[model samples]
Target: MKTKAVRMYGLDDLRLETFDLPEMKEDEILVKVISDSICMSTYKAVKQGKNHKRVPQDVDTNPIIVGHEMAGVIVKVGKKYEGQFLPGQKFSLQPALNYKGSPFSPGYSYPYFGGNATYNIIPPEVMELGCLLVYDGDSYFGASLGEPMSCIIGGYHANYHTVTGKYEHIMGTKAGGDLIIMGGAGPMGLGAVDYALAIDNRPKRVVVADISDDRLKRAARFITPERAKAAGVELIYVNTAAYDDPIAHLMSLTGDKGYDDVFVYAPVKVLVEEGDKLLAKDGCMNFFAGPTDHQFNAPINLYHVHYSNTHIMGSTGGNTDDLKEALYMAANHLINPSVMLTHIGGIDATIDAIMDLPNIPGGKKLIYNHIDMPLTAIEDFGKLGENDPLFKALHERVEKHNGLWNAEAEAYLLKYFDAEA
Candidate 1:
């Protein structure tokens, strides 16, 4: 079958192409991608005209399909895996599919199917390790979220410590502790906020620092007043840019005591230095955003590292532990991942979506691959309106799923919750 996918040709050039699905091998499964979310990695790859470790740049102009965060239903499975997965059942791609004892186990490596396309082929080794979820939950807007949440899991597992070079784990371990989400107005920053609020117990003071007040205001859409009040965490939004000395401002806000945890979700050299300044004595700084291999260059002070006793850590897409936790939380309505999704359009809208990242501020952007399909009735709540045929169809999809979507969507949203709801 021919499926439409967002293919990348070069820098800032992407197109929607209809391509045939690859033949399924004896140890593979075919899936129909329902929804795929725009992730930083995906956005960066298309924007930079090159692929990273997760996305290989096979051919600069070969028009590779770009989408990692996705959820879909299994339509076809090979003879060797008839009972493993059934047709019509929803599923999600773990993305890090690794063969246990094979050369590609864990970090070994392999080229796999990304989520932006209509149908995908997953080999047995990939399926056994990459495929996840058995039941569907919130299918309407789940695929896009799973990938981002997995990155958070990756960050957590990195065991981030303070810049002071402290070997101890200080951040995210106690309550009444402060967290600084630098450049908090963007989608990834919002994801960090959502995850922190959903899980962190420390007196729960979150400082969302960004240059745009409008984006900060928009963060409220995902965090309802009820939810914020219940958490009792003071969510403060600041329009401080990295222009002069943003760290000074953060220290002033915290009375120069520094915060317990700092999530460097967005990359800004000065902001990172400022993070280093505001890290508490036993704090931890998490470099959540995966900056380009060549983009970051700065000097570190050995004195600060030794005296402050801080810890620094970094990670990419998390392992299986993070994905599983995120999915389970999404199933129970702990964190409202859908609220973080700001834009929804078809595959053709991908370019606009990527271009809008720097300006949109908050919320994940989704590529609705199944544009021709009708909407589910109840799923229409967050939609712009019910007039469009697709919106109405989405409303119906929500109703059928009873508040939950397919397994893929549900697993995608799981990363927002800190605790299992």
Candidate 2:
């Protein structure tokens, strides 16, 4: 079969091309990828290429597929997985396949099985590790977003608080405790906010602090303080850059007791230190961002760490269980992963999008694998509508959902712009 995909050859070398796919073995499954969401980790892999821990050194000779957060339909199920998986079933997968303690994952490691392709082969290890997930969501984008949302869920689950005079630590964020997400107005941070509000052990107060007012305003538009209040949580958005003393201003909101949970969403050193200062006794600071620099370091208050039981930790990606939780929550309407989306594109846009992800200045960039369109922002749909009827229709649909992407928009997109059509 012939499949179109974005393949990374070496450092800063990515190509969008059509290639012949080898026949699937009995232990493999064939799939037609529908949607893929671009991730920062992909950008890092592109920059580091073979030097990246997950990317193999032979990528220059045998290029690997460039995406991971993907959703699609099973086109053919091999005999080995006949009953477990069938053709036409909607699916998503946890790309962090730690099979046999190997660092190899789908997006960065695989040559024939990555997300940025029109078709992909599901390898045996994926199914063996139970990373291949069946998604029953209405929108393919929702399934595509499941991977990122899982990371957010994993961060929440990884947070630990010490019990009074106990040697062991309690897993997960504190219940009914004050929580703060530093630099939280971005895409992943927004997901963290949504999960924090929707979780069973909800925080008493949720504070999101960012330097950019525009991003904060956009985040508030989606997950408002009113909405959080209705969920029995107090949500506040603060533009820390506007304050003369940002830490003091944020601490004042917490009644000077400090936050029980502090999530640093940006890898900035200042943000990490600020989060450390805001941590209360037994507070757990989660460094949710992945820094490009290998030697990235931030100083924390050691005094508080020893005397006040404050500590810090970080998570790279979620496990299979976390991915399942994300899918279930999205399907059950407990969390709206659409809030993370800001732009949409086709397979043709994947390369540029991944290459310039940091400068894109928005949330998730979603790519439809079987279309031919450039990366375009949701906010520009209305403007682009003046030139194209498809954009016009998309604009109307997204506007109906308060400028957010929806299943209706996705269906319309496929109907009009499907490459098969």
Candidate 3:
């Protein structure tokens, strides 16, 4: 079948083109792509192209579609997996397949398997590896947000504590401990916040630190103190830049004992250093941001790592189990990952939106399949609602829950932004 997609040809070269997809094998499934959230990883892939570890060396000859955080409906099912899945069933994929210990993944490696297209082919490995998931939720945007949420979950799970005598470390963050989330107002940071708050043994106090007062204020709108209190968590928002001594100010908030856990969400070196400085004895510092340059290095507190029992670590894309947990939590309304979405638009807006993703200055950017609307921020719905009837209706759905995005809003978007409308 012919489809339109943003194909990455080479380094810094991405083109939107119409092409015929290769016929699927008897074991493959065809999916009509619905919603895809632009991830920073996609931008990295587009800029690196063939040089990217998972991308094919002959990427020019085999231009791959370039998105991973996506969801859709199964339009065609193969005989091999017919009984397990059926047409019209909504689904989202765990893009980090890690098949047979291979670093290669769908959007980064597979030519016809990425999410930035109108259609995608689910290879047998995805089904065999149990990466294809049936999404029963109302919002495909929430479903697509699952991948990013899992990544934060994976990092949270990876946090460890050293076993004093055994020379080994215990995994998972300490229950009811002080935690710090640096750059806590960004999309990924907000996701980390949601996951941090909803988990079964939630943090006692979570200090969300950022440089931007505006971003911090906006974040508070969703992760309110009341909401955090309801979750049995004490939410603290702090503008790190407001202090004459930022590290000292953060320590003061934790009563100078420093934080038990610190997760740095930015690739900035200063943030990494600051995160280490705030580590308490036996603290765990998780560098959640993925840097662009392969050789990038941040100065870590080796002294604290050994003496104070403070350990530092980082987690990449989540594992299969993490994806499952994220989906389960989202489907059950246990965590509101929709707080991470600040913008929504049509699939046609994907190319430009993705190219400028680094500068978009918002949370996740969601796209409805086959729509042609420009990128619209959820925050802008109110102002736009004052004039346009379409935005006015959208404002109602988006504003209903204190400016949070929801399935009803997404459903309205899909219906209103379709070709006929």
**Residue lDDT tens for model 2, 40-155:** 88998999999999999899999999899999999998899999998888899999888899999988999999999999998999999888899988889999999999999999
lDDT of 1 by residue, 268-311 (tens): 78767767777887677777666676768545455756877676
- Which 10 consecutive positions of candidate 2 have the poorest summed lDDT? 412-421
Candidate that beats the other on TM-score, 1 or 2, i.e. the better one: 2
Give the higher-lDDT candidate: 1 or 2. Answer: 2
User: Could you list the CA RMSD of all candidates, in the order they appear?
Assistant: 6.8, 1.3, 2.0
Candidate 3 — what's its lDDT? 0.86
- Ordered list by lDDT, greatest first: 2, 3, 1
TM-score of each: 0.76, 0.98, 0.95
Candidate 1: where are CA atoms >4 Å away? 8-15, 47-63, 98-112, 157-173, 200-203, 224-226, 241-249, 252-255, 293-295, 299-301, 351-362, 372-421
User: Global lDDT of each model?
Assistant: 0.62, 0.93, 0.86
> Taking the tens digit of each residue's C-alpha lDDT, what string does model 3 give over 207-313?
99998988998999888889899889989999988889999988988899998889989888899989989999999999888887668787887887778988888
lDDT of 2: 0.93
TM-score of 3: 0.95
